[model samples]
Target chain A: MDALRITHVEGTALPMRGEDVDTDRIMPARFLRAVTFEGLEQHVFEDERSGSVAGDRAKEQHPFDNPQYAGASILLVNRNFGCGSSREHAPQGLRRWGIRAVVGESFSEIFFGNSVMIGLPCVTVSPDELHELMERVEERPSAVLRIDLTAGTCEIDGFTCAIGLPAAARDALVTGAWDTTGLLLARYEEVNAVAATLPYVAGF
Target chain B: MGKTLLQKVWDAHAVRILPTGQTQLFIGLHLIHEVTTPQAFDALRARGWKVSRPDRTFGTVDHIVPTRERNRPFLDLLAEDMITALEKNCHDFGIRLAGLGDDRQGIVHVIGPELGLTQPGMTIACGDSHTSTHGAFGAVAFGIGTSQVRDVLASQCLAIEPLKVRRIKVDGVLPRGVYAKDVILAIIQKLGVGGGVGYAYEYAGSAIDRMSMDERMTICNMSIEGGARVGYVNPDQTTFDYLKGRPFAPEGEAFERAKAWWASMASDADARYDDEVVIRAEELTPLVTWGVNPGQSIGVGGRIPSVDASLPDQQAVADALAYMGLEGGKPIAGMRVDVAFIGSCTNSRLSDLREAARIVKGRHVAPHVKGLVVPGSVAVKRAAEREGLDEIFRTAGFEWRDAGCSMCLGMNPDKLVGDQVCATSSNRNFKGRQGSPTGRTLLMSPAMVAAAAVAGEVVDVRELSAEVAAGAI
Candidate 1:
């Protein structure tokens, strides 16, 4: 019953189908001015959702802007989601905008790491499974989708499929150890010892 | 099985295995910049902790600094505030900062290697994704989130999951006018943007071995774009020669000792890898991105890809074509460009500037195109000016600007106006990357960007080089 343990996530899903949806598209660089990540929810996908890009044909029906997907806590996306930039702001914005978890075909390594650090689970499903989940969410935006990290399964409308996450990431999320500062600090002496052994740190 | 350089470096830096099955890895060097550190510092305060190893940390102001104006209290209040916060944070945390007035001030990635702070066999962490740029020196460096930034600040350690090593071998000599930028672009195009996920790219083969250290950095800088969190080259004579006598690098006997350790850290001849990819360098040409991502690119002589309904990435291609306002099957050459930017951590070093200057020496930018050349660092600026590269650019109708990541990400005032097509040397071509929401970006080599500026469109740099040799400019 630990509040921090994210063994399972169940909520409405928002489908945004696009490969390599980069961090810049998720949160534009202009909004990165503030020292804190506050108020980022209002600006998530600010450019795409608002059709700010000139001649952008796919701007009209951005899932973030669609009213049907409002309050959706799970985001379903295609491959290579969050591809460019190491900005934690992208995942922060998604989390703040009511996205608790993401199910995608694939994710960039940095983006995947950033999401886990913030306790936003990013699981990968097979292409077929992701397509089916996206189609289901589009057809029934209010349908509840459940992801169980411990069991590595995603269930929607009684259709069950395996989801993939790194074993370490799954353990961190299930044990509430995703915010790893304390876990890292527990071995502070060992860290210093390792640093001392490095030739570069000791100036050879 | 023999060990890859990644394995050796990882083993060296690993402190302990955490309870969650992740390794607690000690960071040898931590680089910080204005955009990502304010919150990280605040998090440290909340935890009642101090930076465990200030000596290992370095800070700089780059993302929000204006390349045009060097004055205090920047016109952009938010930019000014960011710099001020970094200044206060560095001072409070006892970390050294290369502020705007400092001669060493520049892009974090640029200054780290320039000042010899990035060394081989060490684990470097930065808040910026281009931290992979340091891996050119055979280091295990990767970008981290702000929370990990706080972790390194508090304990000089991070909970990290190990990655598999992928050996990307680019053999054969590069044809003239095909630069390191094109090599990486070709790799990204061949391997889908996400192809390198869960892997550390160990760049090898004859072509990589022959490249200068600066060129190696350019190749490593964009590894993140290919979804590899870490990328590196094995340390060799090129790496050691570049490090010797640099400001922060060890002196004389110590340097000799360090070089031995670095060379030993290289991957063994029989090192095992999870996967292997081989590319022929001679087959590559000057490449350019015509879509929203780095992977959506074509060679200078190739046409933009047409969207076929049955293709695996058809929807992605269609979306890219729609956002870029480009037609399918059109020749990438002669695509109109309104802006030309020759700067960024990817291609703003001395050799990059020299190549661009060589192209623009006797030519002028097209009247309709705005051209800029921002150096990567103040030292680079001074060096370029000393070589009179600035005069060459200014005379060629390109604005010679101060150091920083000028129009690369457009964190500063130098940006593309609405819908302007920019032929740039920056890494990412993500939509709105250069400040304008709809501004289009074409990623190319610096020489190609220079040639594009002169032609006011995309043109083959090899053809332009031939024309330049014929005195046709």
Candidate 2:
């Protein structure tokens, strides 16, 4: 089977400035009523984008609403992005909303895992470097940024910085092994063998 | 060197090192709920894959189940459709489901332990982030996304990277008013919300050892809140005792054998951890989150942190303050609470209910405050009602509700209306966490929520304890 290798991602950037932005904010709990994740992109940051006070319909000043960053496929964020709730919907919504890659100072482990599983690469840079990237994105929302998973670097406007993706994650992305179900299913016998050895599974 | 429980459990479950350098670790148990399973089931059908270990997988309807009403064709049609989808998926896959109207039905985390399905030396995967709650049994449990859920269903395994283990030791006895909720909140405050990323937390020391199984569950439940996907306690006599006669636990001689295996899975005395953090239980006060995230908390007696422009987290602090509509430097104690809630996988067990009821026995909820007490599970609700704890809460003017994740994430009908400030016993104070986009949450222990319910504001639970002792009420 041919694997889909994602060696590099290049796109216009959208900068959302916040620290510890939780999944609940990305996709509120009410939107989770659906049986499928379809149409979740429309509700990404639904509450944050629309002010909730007194049923106000005025759109909040959010980067997702900024016309300059319209159609941007790269998300630039600050420290601890996607920090709460293990909802894969957070990344799914972001991906559906056209965020192909995310570059932040840090990411919640589950969010990182979920993003990688869906073929969306989440890479990290130093806080200082991330601030610079956010500034660069804000200065020119149309600036194209490129994330090289194999090279482990992010470059924008002739400026380059080291990006951090765990070696395992990077290898998986570059090899298109991120959707791990097929890979895991191939080792079915091995899985049963391991389970059989456990006292709990083997009934002591 | 000796091995930590994480290493031992991981090594035991590991099938092989994949070509991508991730481990193919077998999952012994896979728990599913309404919200995250339908898409996974669809993916499985798309691939024409059968559940590899249907016996090991269990399903429950919780997230979108309404707490107040439980009739066919739910008031929320979307919720009914989601639960119906889960039922159909579970039925098609031959997975056991504790759906609505089943006594076993409850929050997945609560029902798992209550039924003894969560055991030590196992790898538990659930579609919910709070799956870490199962780690209280010494299991290597963590939350997985829908794709990983699909992987587990197809292969009973996950391709994942290993994590470093951090030993968090909290010594000494907890103060009178402090509880496991406070201990975890204190730990999150000491360690930033993102501090535990890429690591598993091994909760040790005398304080953790002294906690009951429920308290330990409360501690492990919020590991995800601290960016740690897994947190656990070492199995001991307490763990064994809790599992002794549990419905799913082994019987007679088999139970003894399982105990031996479970005890052996505890971290060796000389085990090496990647990191260690030591905290004193005496220093901790009943903590309350004053900001949006769990880490932005302080002692009830302490003031909300004032934002300093020079600090790197200044923006975060400022934003939280702005969103919470509170001034920094103000005491967290007397903040007006429009709602008081006690329930979630975090603290809706029998003990949590009993403790909250203790404070609500003779006290009436403040007229202006909307008080709610939701039990975590049907079993918990039954147990609390058997003990007449529900009567105490109802008499105190708090709405005693059925079991579900009500008002916790607010996927159900129980939710805050607007910008109401709620003193909640559940975890997570993120923006719109309790249903209303503008609703604000102040997370604390159940007793503290009860105190706030009566006082119409946040008050130190210790003060209320003292009042009870003094016969002031």
Candidate of highest DockQ:
1
Writing each residue's lDDT as its tens digit, candidate 2 over A116-194 gives 9999999999988988888888888889999988878999988899999998898888888888888888757777788
Error of 1 at A201 (Å): 1.1
- For residue B319, what is the lDDT in candidate 1? 80
Cα-based lDDT at residue B44, candidate 1: 92
TM accuracy, model 1 = 0.98
Query: Pairs clashing in candidate 1?
Result: none
DockQ of the two-chain complex in candidate 2: 0.80
Tell me the DockQ of each model, to 2 decimals: 0.83, 0.80
Per-residue CA lDDT of model 1 for A1-204, tens digit only, reads 256789999999999887889999899898898899999999898887645544254545777888999999999998899989899999999999999999999998889999999999999999999989998888898899999999999999989999999899999999988888888877577887898899888889
Error of 1 at A72 (Å): 0.8
What value does the lDDT take at residue A135 in candidate 2? 85
lDDT of each: 0.92, 0.90
User: How closely does chain A match the true chain A in each prediction, as TM-score?
Assistant: 0.95, 0.94
Error of 2 at B120 (Å): 0.8
**Among all windows of ten consecutive residues in candidate 2 chain B, which has the lowest summed lDDT?**
B310-319
